[model samples]
Target: MSFLFNSYPLARAALFSMDAEKAHDLTLSALQKAYDCSLTRGLLAAHPQLPCTLMGLSLRNPVGLAAGLDKNGAHIDALGNLGFGFVEVGTVTPKAQPGNPRPRMFRLPRAQCLINRMGFNNHGLDAFIANVRKSQWRSQGGILGLNIGKNAATPIDNAVDDYLLGLEGVYAHADYITVNISSPNTANLRNLQGRDALSALLSPLQEKRKMLEDQYGRRVPLAIKIAPDLTTEEIDVIANLLPQHGIDGVIATNTTLARDAVQGLPYANEAGGLSGPPVHALSLAVISRLREQLGAGYPIIGVGGIATGRQAQEKIAAGANAVQLYTGLIYQGPALVQQCVNALR
Candidate 1:
């Protein structure tokens, strides 16, 4: 564990020197190899105080690795070993697609942020399910959140079909599933957050979920991941709809399209969602508003710009039942997971 903490600076330096997307690929490859060799097990010291429960799932800690980091479930065990209580993978679609073109991911080192328009480039549900089945963490009953989305080619009006397909495919394998309709990279995807669209999307999915529960003999929870760029009125509408739809939880924020916080920085004008410190305040604001509308019992998984222990604590204070990380891992290294867990304790 100490070795992991001590060695990351040099590792990060090498990664930071390369193209952001390439660096990400290399990191995933290395992590995969480490897991294959069983070298990642116990690589971090576990914090006992981090235990909690959300959406009926028993999390070993409140800190989790966010979706988009694993897009596929390929590295769940390896990531789980890094001290996150849970690991979410995928914004996986029903079919395999290449996603947006190259150089789609950027790093704004000055703001400790990243901008990406990767779309939902995943190896389709078949490959994703295979990876999920291969994961040792899943075998061990570690909480796994499978995030689902529509294919880029799927029209917005017919988007429900794609989501329904996603639901049917991953339902049995996931501990909970997240309907991701807020990524800015996907065209018109955020429109699903509107009142009519949101209701239309969730109502049928909720019906299917009940049928799935009867088939599987367990009621796997469903959470919706929303964007941070929403207006207060938009938040109010969503808050009202969630419980009405019988949704089990909400992940407050995907990434933001707004770049106000990173103005003047390189890649600040990139056409994608901006994450890291720039998103911290926006995410907290959304969570605070959602907390106010949803009352005390609804589960909210807050995620966005959580780069430090204090920020993680602040998210909880703002009413998140648990929190997740992605860009923070890029700048702060894996130790951030334990740092957050310790702070939450």
Candidate 2:
């Protein structure tokens, strides 16, 4: 643990010097190699007190690696070894897409935030499923969540088709499926959160889920990832709709378009969702509101700007059943996972 903790500054310095996306890719590749060599598995610490259950899935801990970090499900085993109790991969679409062009990811070191317009760029559902099938983590009892989204080329009216396709493809392999209707990057994706469109989208997916449960002989939970920018009324409306649609859980946020927190900082004007410390308060507010509206027993997975043990505890205090990390991992390293789990315990 000391070696892992002590060495990150040098590693992060090297990564910070490179392009953000390239550094991300290189880091994933290196982590994969480390896991393949069985080096990281022993280095990671596990807390017995961290176990918890949510959405009927038995997680070894409440700390999870959020979606967008491993968008294609390509590094599940490597990431799983980082001591996260669960790992979510993808904002994957039914078809392959290149996402936004290069320089699409920017780092705001001063704010401990990131702004990305990656646009759900992934290698389509088939490849994504294949990668999941190839991962050793599935057999190791790691809880895996697959987040599904519509293709960028698919018109908003036809969005259900892409999600249905993605659901069909990853259903058997995932512990849960996240229907992502909240990404600000995919043009007009957030519009699906409106009352009429949300109902139209979730209704058929709920119906299809029943059929899939029977076919697969298992009931994999379905969760919805929502945006943090929604109004109180909008949050209340969606909160009411979740139980009505039989959705299993709600991931409190994706990212934010608001810039007040990062004002006057570099990349503050970049046109993408802002994450990290800038989103902590807003995400917490959404979680608290959702918990109030959904009532006790509804699962809420809190995310956004959790960089310390106290922040992780705050998410739980705000009524999250579980919590996840992404931007925090960038600034704090893998030790942060252990810290949060210990804090929760």
- lDDT tens readout by residue for model 2, 258-285: 9998889988899999999878899999
Scored by CA lDDT, what does every candidate get? 0.92, 0.92
Give candidate 1's whole-model lDDT: 0.92
TM-scores, one per candidate = 0.98, 0.98
Q: How do the residues 1-345 of candidate 1 rate in per-residue lDDT, one tens digit apiece? A: 778776888999999999999999999888767767744545643443566899988988889989999998888887887878888999899999999998899999999999999999999999999999888786775789999999999999999999999999999899999999999998999999999999999999999999999999999999999999999999999999999999999998889988888899999999999999879899999999999999999999999999999999999999999999999999999888888988998
So what's the TM-score on candidate 1?
0.98
> Which 10 residues in a row give candidate 1 its minimum summed lDDT?
39-48
Clashes of 2: 0
* Model 2 TM-score, all chains together: 0.98
